[model samples]
Target: MATSLFKEILFRKKITDDLNVGERKIIIFDEANNGNMGDQAIVYAQTEFIKKNFPTDRILHFSIAESIGILKH
Candidate 1:
């Protein structure tokens, strides 16, 4: 459902192309598989909701399970 919605947004071109050249290179991470506390749940939903809006080749889809970042004290 999320993927479909994103596709719709992209198809309609409703989203603003405000990204810069450097920003475009960044991949939006859904973080569903991640265990970090700082990760925004809404953003995850939004990410999942709008994933298909972007090109598959250019975007890197990552789930919470795939994230393995370690925080140091």
Candidate 2:
């Protein structure tokens, strides 16, 4: 678990360095994909809003659950 967390952290930094996340970084700290329609819609809407409003900004989504998507997928 600790290793996974560490890798996730490193990957985040690497992505920032690689993609050059500028002043506007939209970070969704804790995301859930537990098949909840409301939750999914919230995330979707949040992302869409960001994309429409902050077109040039970057989005970093972190999942605080048993299955972390960034590393797994």
Candidate 3:
């Protein structure tokens, strides 16, 4: 079965001249085919694509139980 993959990236925003900062989390979700065959490989490939396209400070991943359509804004 296919699952929706979620990647959240956190970035530090400088708030003060003395190095104080705040962290912001940006969430991105992508739906992919993850049937009984080649699910892991597909997921890995998708991850690499995201990493190359949207390099960030940190990344967090999760799987959604349901499939979803992707949209860009």
TM-score of candidate 3 to 2 decimals = 0.36
lDDT of model 1 at residue 11? 44
Error in Å for residue 61 of model 2: 0.5
- Candidate 1 local lDDT, 1-73, one digit each (tens): 5655444444454443543335453345434544554566755665665555744424444444323221110
Q: Which candidate is the best by lDDT?
A: 2
Best by TM-score: 2
In model 1, the Cα lDDT at residue 56 comes to 44
Compared with the true structure, all predictions reach lDDT values of 0.45, 0.69, 0.40
**Segments in model 3 whose C-alpha atoms lie over 4 Å from true places:** 1-37, 64-73
lDDT of 2 by residue, 1-73 (tens): 6666645674755753643334667777567677999988988998999999999888876666523544455
Candidate 3 local Cα displacement, residue 11, angstroms: 17
Clashing pairs in 1: 32-64, 33-63, 33-64, 33-65, 34-64
Model 2 per-residue lDDT at 23:
62
